[model samples]
Target chain A: MSLTADDVNKIAYLARLGIDTQDTESYAKDLSGMLDLVAQMSNINTDDVAPMAHPLDQVQRLRTDAVSETNNREAFQKIAPQVEAGLYLVPKVIE
Target chain B: MHTKTIAQLAKGLRAGDYSSQELTASYLARIKQHTELNSFITVTEEQALTVAKQADMALATGNAPLLTGIPIAHKDIFCTQGVKTSCGSKMLDNFIAPYNATVVEKLDTAGTVSLGKLNMDEFAMGSSNETSFYGAVHNPWASNTVPGGSSGGSAAAVAARLIPGATGTDTGGSIRQPAALCGITGLKPTYGRVSRFGMIAYASSLDQGGPMTQTAEDAALMLQAMAGFDAQDSTSVEREVPDYSAGLNNSLQGLKIGLPKEFFDDGLNNDMASCIETAINEYKKMGAEIIEVSMPNLKLAIPAYYVIAPAECSANLSRMDGVRFGHRCTDPVDLNDLYIRSRGEGFGTEVKRRILVGTYALSEGYYDAYYIKAQKIRRLISDDFKRALQEVDVIMGPVSPSPAFGIGEKTSDPIEMYLADIYTIAINLAGLPAMSIPAGFIDNKPIGLQIIGNYFAEDKLLNVAHQYQQVTDWHQQTPQGFA
Candidate 1:
């Protein structure tokens, strides 16, 4: 149930929360505490039970394939972090 | 004027006792007075007065709806157009919602004036309201005690008479826990009962919005306008919205009540247990039969909830990638740094911890071991509720283990804070309707008697709460200073 420093780094990387050497120890302790909490469930055998994905057995609802909403790109992009020329500007990925 | 319930206010508004503008002013003044409570994030005074003037005009023409001109403080979780819907997190601190959430739009259409945004836990994560980036909301009953949260601000404001009624979203007892501690009435309708179109996502499977008010009748009136089907929300149930106000006077004769044995174990506070026992006896005297029920799987609810909620939240919050909308770190060398720092800087400790845990649970190798195991136990918990519900009309229990605790009491330990919701989370897993009504007080703080019912049984739940409220005066008792 204990998470190692390496394990903590992997989790931090997966979750996309910046973690350095100092914070990793505390993160390890906190996460290990939680992992121990969930580890108890593993003891009770759930061999035949189906995993409950949702409270209700709902189908994936579909609507007619047609454009319903008017274009509000200008309104939506106004809140973006960095947008220019009607496009979101993210960090350089390819270049 | 501030102490009047929504029902009374609606009546007075129609009778021309006062205009919506006058009532709106009173609430605004009190919001200014109770700055120490930290209950509100933004008081939209100018917008409220403008809406109130329109409501007054509507009421004068004798063409007003049920809740026309009543003032309501909305939870900051909902997206109110042109207002800051922070959800008590720095991630969305700069987020000024461009469009109104469905709850906001529906309430506005009914002519209820918006008093502004109420505070909440950071992304509805904390049991105590202390997780808010805006600062923790103080319990109205005691200045130093924490108001039971996620909906802490909504409950505190209503108890302090800052607003007669307010809207709160309960992911895992957010609405009910605060309502209990603050000596107010709150309802969390069956999952999918209310539209979640624009309500900020916490755990998509468990989130449901309902009313937090002084009386069950007021809750009914507010809920009538709030519940409905929407094309926007994928999980919104397509059903007829009953007249919740009409069922308030239904007789409680021969009502069957089940008290879950698991809820009253050795961990329960003695004082809170006594108060709940007294409330149950009151129900028995009102011609309701009480029976002992067993929900063996209820013990696993907290663990299962923590796992399921965090996992869902991890997926849901992935939308906040700094590029779209929210706080972005300065001078990012690459997208990875942008994602990491923006989220790291934006979220608080508890939020980050949950995100990390969720990512671990949902990651490649551990998915089957943790996430699937919790989901399986979730089925057992749901089955337990389904079985117990068949034997009884409703299940009764404590909304929380004890009344409101000191603000910093459980802040250092997340597990202790999570255990506070041990009595309440299973209902969300079962997707049933439940409520916390003011039962009594423990050491000057309030305790709520929780009534849980089967799916789509909100009408019956509200009826029972209203009947109990009729016989007891607990819901009528306001905090000393506030009164």
Candidate 2:
């Protein structure tokens, strides 16, 4: 259950985080140690066990489909780092 | 006086001893004086004063609720209308929610004055408040030590007497662990007891908002206003919320308390064990019965919680892409960069680590082996609580294995930090109600005794905690330097 440096790199890439190459070795070691602890779960017999999602067995209730809120575009966009014409502007995606 | 409890304050307000404006002003002054603790993310002084004035008018008309005009703080996790709901992450740092969370609305309806939003672990991911984008909260008891988190700010604020009471969300040990470390009362009610609508989701299944206060009765009083069925939150229970404050004085006679043998085994520190034993002995003298019970699956709680919590978090946090809302990258050549840079820049280190682990666990090839397997194990943990509860009315144990550790004690070692939550994570996994009450002090530091109950057993848990407070003065004791 050892996590290789490659595995750590792949995970970091997927998460979009830049980890220093020097730290990768230590992170791999630490992650492998954590995986070893997590690996213990494989020993338990769960053949008949049902996967529990919610704490209660009840069904989710539905609210009316009617609109409870009005458009507050100005108020909503006030927190954006950058915005114009009721549109959120991000980095240019096309050439 | 600043030290008065919520009940006392409410009584005083009723008696015209102090107006809501004065109380609100006192709390605002305290917040200003205690800026070194970094307990608050934002303080709503103008809004608080306006609310206080309205409360004073209501009181003059003799029509105020029990919690009317009492100053309180909300965990940043709960969304407040027109207030920034950052969840301590950079992604939503500038995001002000348009709607109020159910808990906040309920408290506002009760006429409670809002002091501000408290700090927390980013997306409620870490145990220590250091993960917060705002800054870490210092434990009021020991300035150098961390106030245990992700509810660190709420606990520190309440314990420091900056606010009489505050709200906190517990996904893992967020509320109870911090409350224990900060020497206050924090309760995590049954999963469906409190509505989660508008509460920024970390792990939806485990997230619940409750009260962090100076006494069990105060927790109960706040819970009374916070808990109920909400049509907005599909997961909210339809069952009536019992009057939690009504049974605070109930006799503890014939109450069966189960002491899980596993909780007291190795890894249980002597000081914490002694404090718990003393508290249990006091309960015994007050006519309560204690029986030893076994829950073998207790050892698996941490592992199971790690899997389930992250798996859910991976899905929940995916919505933070640099598209509809939240942080965005400055320049992107393509959509992929937009997504990647936005997330990389927005999330903190611990949050990114969790998102990676969760994404890996739920990935195409690993779903069955990790995510699905953890779900099955989650059921076993819940069943363990059910079986143990059938034999006893409540389960008692140490909230954390030890008192507040130094600020950097386990910051570098994730495993060591994870183990700190060993005693508290199981309750969240089982979706049961639990509370951390100030048991006693060890080496001049505070220790907490955990009381766990069956689903919707908040009333009983509070009763036990309240009765314990009646016999002991531990909750009344404050840290020396701060006082």
Best by DockQ: 1
Model 2 spans with C-alpha error above 4 angstroms: A12-27, A63-69, A82-85, A89-95
Poorest 10 consecutive residues of model 1 chain B by lDDT? B411-420
Candidate 1 per-residue lDDT, tens place, B360-391, comes to 89999888988899989999999999999999
Let me know the DockQ for model 1.
Answer: 0.82
Tell me the whole-model lDDT of each prediction, alpha carbons only.
0.91, 0.89
RMSD of each: 1.0, 1.8
Off by over 4 Å in 1: none
In model 1, state the lDDT of residue B424: 83
The residue pairs in collision within model 1 are none
Q: Can you tell me the CAPRI class of model 2? A: medium
The CA root-mean-square deviation of candidate 1, after full C-alpha superposition on the true structure, stands at 1.0
The numbered model that scores best in lDDT is 1
Error of 1 at A29 (Å): 1.2
What lDDT does candidate 2 reach at residue B243? 88
